[model samples]
Target: MEVEITTEEKILIAARKVFIEKGWDGARMQEIADNAGINKALLHYYFRNKEQLFKRVFAGIVGKLIPNLNTIIQSEQPIFEKIQAFIDAYLDFLLANQELPLFVANELSRNANLIVGAFEENGLKPMVGQMVMEIFQAIENKQIRPINPAHLLMNIVSMCVFPFMGRSIFQKVLMQVPEEMYQELLKQRKKEIYEMVYHSIVL
Candidate 1:
């Protein structure tokens, strides 16, 4: 079945591709419009300017990642189950949007306040506190080691997110693996992270 694509939708998708390949500095409004098969005037009519367009695209990215995240953290699932599911789902999100992470990192370097604003609008702050308390209870029950779960959680996230952010370097400077081989390496990481974390946390 063929799905319909709107002019705005086309522009956003095209912008996402360009921004990922070029980063914001290298991306051009005219190039985005060309990619979308629309004129720059039409793009402006919808998005106003480059910064506005990036914010809209970034909001879409955050929305995709955050909603289900809050639900999983607040759920009554055991920590191990949550760990497996969270890693799987998060990796899926990363793979689906390969350009998303770098664009976000680039944009964050420019204006953290913008991303913070999106988090506020999206109600992400409350979820952090919720996850911390959930972790506290798991520790009290001896389900996991007595680590500061918040810091531990942050480390887990960094372990996952950093490799993607550093993908170019990992492939070129480190392993020097070409495209197909490097993808297989990433496939291994999905389970490896879970195993590494599980063994570290359990006695």
Candidate 2:
């Protein structure tokens, strides 16, 4: 016998695909319903509307990524090790979810507050505090150069995320590397970013 998927799961699954493909602005409830093999009224009954549905979808995407950063921050590893691990995990996640950054960036532009709410709801503050404490400890031990941890974090995130943001341009226009070669290059980038981040701050 075929297992039955719940109405909510079916809607969310369909919504995830639609949102990933067309983004929040372009995705319509009717399309989501049709893809879900349900009617529009049922979709609305579960999600209320596109904004609400998109938020749930966005939260699921963000949920996959954010907690990993928290783990790296809260770990007992040395700063350099943390940097290496973070680059490895972060880049790997982004490469696997190539469409995610653009979707997040687009949604954030129009719904910054909503995105902030999602982070807050997920307990971002304690994770941020843990990271801050780690940065302070590293600086105090003179294991790393003195720098604003928040700024440093942003720099690291930007370096890690920019390639994904420019994926189409980088793959299709500028470097024009073959698919297999491009993927290999991304693997190399994990090391390159780790080294650059480590050397920049290491004593």
Candidate 3:
């Protein structure tokens, strides 16, 4: 069955693209309307102004992507298995939402508090203690070498995020790689990242 998409949804989709590409300061209402195939009056009717529209777009994207990090720390699977699962899920999500990494990186640089607030509002916080305990347990079991969970978390995030975040520059300017090849490289990242992380910590 064909799903019906409402006007509001259309607006939001259009806004997401514009906000990601042009960013909050660069996006304009008329451009969003053109993207959505709607008039400015209707856009304004749906979203009173640019700020309101941007907030909804930002929140929607962050809510979808950021909260899933909890699953890796909370899972009952062994540490290596959890890492593999996280890489699979995180990379898949990032690949499907290519624009998201840059958008998130930019937002985090400009107004980090907003991103933090979004996570808190979405009930994705208060897991730090749990994550630390999980890491300690893994080390005690000799599943991984003893290390600060924060460093491990950052390593995971950087490996998963930097490629997408620097796609244009790294893949295009410096590497001068063809889009097809870069895409193929991305396809192999799940295993590549898993092996790298596993070897870093495992005995």
Candidate 4:
């Protein structure tokens, strides 16, 4: 048996669905109200306006971003292991919420400042931009080879995130491995991918 949720919770759930489907531009307060089985006035009584409601939903999505990645980004772990862990964690985050990346990208495109503010709020600070510089310095200090760390990071993320992010495109135009099969593939990828990354970075 399932207990019913409060109207506020219902509104938030409806907003999430609308935002994911229509993005920030296309989402409408009336649509959200309709989705929640409430009138627009009731939705307004709860959320004030569409923008406020949108923020609530967007904030929840932003919070899904794992903060621990910052520690891993600056870690002394062998760069390859760090890369593998990063891919696994990041991809796992997306797997848990398939619409998140697209939602962020879409909303950011709508308001770059909002995206920046969200990052700041999330304590990501400026770590991503400097992540490569720190890695390069490690290489210069003989901790690793002179390979480009930013390129490595991007490649690993692309391999992990893109396959699923572009799942429809891949299944339609290229491969059509079932979802479970893809999950199995991802499960087996960490080791091989790390070895490949290790080979590139190790002296």
Candidate 5:
């Protein structure tokens, strides 16, 4: 059975594509409306301005990414397994949305408050707190070496997100690999990240 997409969904779909390709500063309302197969006035009727539409798109992406974390954090998996699972899931998401990191980084530079607000509203703070508590529990149980949970969390996120965020340099200058090869490398990165993180904190 086919599920019908609503007008708002269509708009959001089109907006995501445009935003990813162009970044918030580069994206235009008319272009988004055209991509959505709607007139500019109609698009305005749905979204008052480009900023509003961009916020919705950013919030939607956060919404998609956070629930996965919530699930992983609440699971009964061991610490190492949880780390591996997060890396796998996060990398998989980055692979599917290859342009997202760059898009997010660009927008964040322009208006960090907006991005931060979106994340906070989507429950990122509580999720991070829960993850931190998990790390502390692991340390107390002697499952991993004692370390500041915040630093460990930051390290894990940086390792996973940096490659995609710096894709142009990493792909073209650093590695000089073709797109196909770079993508293959990203797939391999999931394991590499897990190992590096595991060895760093493991007893």
Candidate 6:
């Protein structure tokens, strides 16, 4: 049985594709309405304007990606174990949403406040504080080397996110690997990233 997609769902589906492809500045209401098989008037009826539509789409993406970090960071797992789990989950999400990094980069370049607002609204600051405290505890117990927690966190995020953001140059130009092979490389990165991060901080 084919499930019926609601009017709002259809609008969101079309809006996500349009916004991701064009960013906030380039996306058009007519294009979104056409993609959704609706009229522009109806689109405006659902969302007041393009900014509102873009915010809705951006919020949904950030909501999915950020809440998981909060959950994992708050868990009682050891620091290294948390690191491994975070890499696994983060890579899995990026694999599914390969276009996300580029889209986010483009949008952020246009308006930094969008991403910052999303993070603030999601309680990411407290999560970061918790993770830093965990790193401090690990260092105190001699579980890891003495490293700045902020730097370690930045390194971990860069390693996980940069490949996706630079996929075209890294996969096509530099590596010159085919799509299937490139996918395999990303899968391998989960373990590879965990090991690299583990060794970097471990004594």
Give the per-residue lDDT of model 5 (tens digit) for 86-197: 8888888888777788777888899898788767665554377788998999999999999999898888889988988998899899889999998888899988988999
What is candidate 6's lDDT per residue for 131-155, written digit by digit as tens?
8999999999999999999999888
The TM-score leader among the candidates is 6
Q: What is the C-alpha RMSD of each candidate to the true structure, in Å?
A: 2.2, 2.0, 2.3, 3.2, 1.9, 1.5
Native-to-model Cα distance after best TM-score fit, residue 49 in candidate 2, in Å: 2.1
Better of 4 and 5 by TM-score: 5
Local error of candidate 5 at 163, Å?
Answer: 1.2
Candidate order by lDDT, highest to lowest? 6, 5, 3, 2, 1, 4
Question: Judged by lDDT relative to the true structure, which candidate is superior, 2 or 6?
Answer: 6
Q: lDDT per residue, candidate 3, 32-136, as tens digits?
A: 999999999999999998877877776777666556766666778877787788788789888888878888789889878766665666565635678778888
The TM-score values for the models, in the order shown, are: 0.87, 0.90, 0.87, 0.77, 0.91, 0.94
Per-residue accuracy of model 4 over 50-122 as CA lDDT, tens digit each:
7678777766765555465666777787655666767667766777786676667667778888667645554
lDDT string for model 1 (121-144, tens) is 655553777777867887889888
Better of 3 and 5 by TM-score: 5
**lDDT of candidate 1 at residue 117, scale 0 to 100:** 73
By TM-score, the candidates rank as 6, 5, 2, 1, 3, 4
User: Which residue runs does candidate 2 get wrong by more than 4 Å?
Assistant: 1-4, 122-126
Ranked by lDDT, the better of candidates 3 and 4 is 3
> Lowest lDDT 10-mer window, candidate 2?
118-127
Kindly state the number of residue pairs that clash in model 2.
Answer: 0
Clashing pairs in 5: none
